[model samples]
Target: MATEGSNSPLRFASVEASVPKITIQFCIQCKWNLRAAYYAQELLQTFSTSLGEVSLRPSTGGVFIVTLETFNQHSVLESHTIWDRKRDGGFPETKELKKKVRDIIDPQRDLGHVDGKKSATNPPAHPANAGHTRELKDVAAQVVDGPVKVSKLQDNRPESLGVQLVQAQNSSKSQDKAECEDCK
Candidate 1:
């Protein structure tokens, strides 16, 4: 009973009604079907289990909008606009779109590369390693037992006053002795 001019997508009786739905409306006059379909496929592939359906609705006047709809316990449908071409400035990038959709349906879910660039050289340190700087520990432990020496202030500035750090000479001698004993 569907007509050719109808923009409504086909639905099945077996489809689950509880899961969140995504609707992407693109301008048919602008020939954006492929672009809309691409976004739909990306969303479905990323959130296969969390989303129920991603419908592509045709529209006119250069309209491109993505919306999410969720059903509450009372079965009241709550709709939120994820992207509006006019309001959002233009179509969203693939990663940005995925991030937005993920935030809406499953906020805790991680989209891997879509999440963002991560520095490989300096990965985030664990909380347990916060106070475990070996160099600082070694330097502090080797401090010579003597009166604290305050050097002459530079440029007559109180902030520039330097505190001289003296390392225990006996500490190096003990380390050398230990290395010799290990060799023996």
Candidate 2:
């Protein structure tokens, strides 16, 4: 047994420096706790030194928000809505989530291939978009290389046209579902 004043090895308690905190509020009703926790773990692991804590808060409704706060001050510095079932209709991609968090925590950080522009420019030879990526690249090249003339419509704007198209597609999908159900 070591005595009180024995010549034993001196041991020092490890002290961890506190950094900023990140809070992820996930909706319990929407069953997004696992998704939120996974994101929290990813963020914590990525920014271990820069982050002090990552907390998860269960909320009602369909809210999936990520908030960054100061550890010592306990004040929220920035917040981002990672997902909103009612508003966005679906969950965000992992890359998108990482980009949002990176923007808040470390603005200048590079996410390599996860960045949209980089991936868009150097698209993989996969059937992910069914060659739509090439078409988009061509359109983008055309737009950048020359002055594109926009034909103005008398009663419709581009934004309104997009909204109308989306509404039409949604209505058609609902009709298709109804027709399928009738057939069954």
Question: Which candidate has the highest TM-score of all?
Answer: 1
After TM-score superposition, the amount by which residue 147's alpha carbon in candidate 1 deviates from its true location, in angstroms, is 77
Model 1 ranges off by over 4 Å: 1-18, 117-184
Give the Cα lDDT of each candidate.
Answer: 0.73, 0.61
Task: Looking at model 1, report the run of 10 residues with the lowest lDDT sum.
Answer: 175-184
lDDT of 1 at 172: 32
Tell me the TM-score of model 2.
0.44
Cα TM-score per model: 0.53, 0.44
Give the Cα error of residue 131 in candidate 1, in Å.
Answer: 42
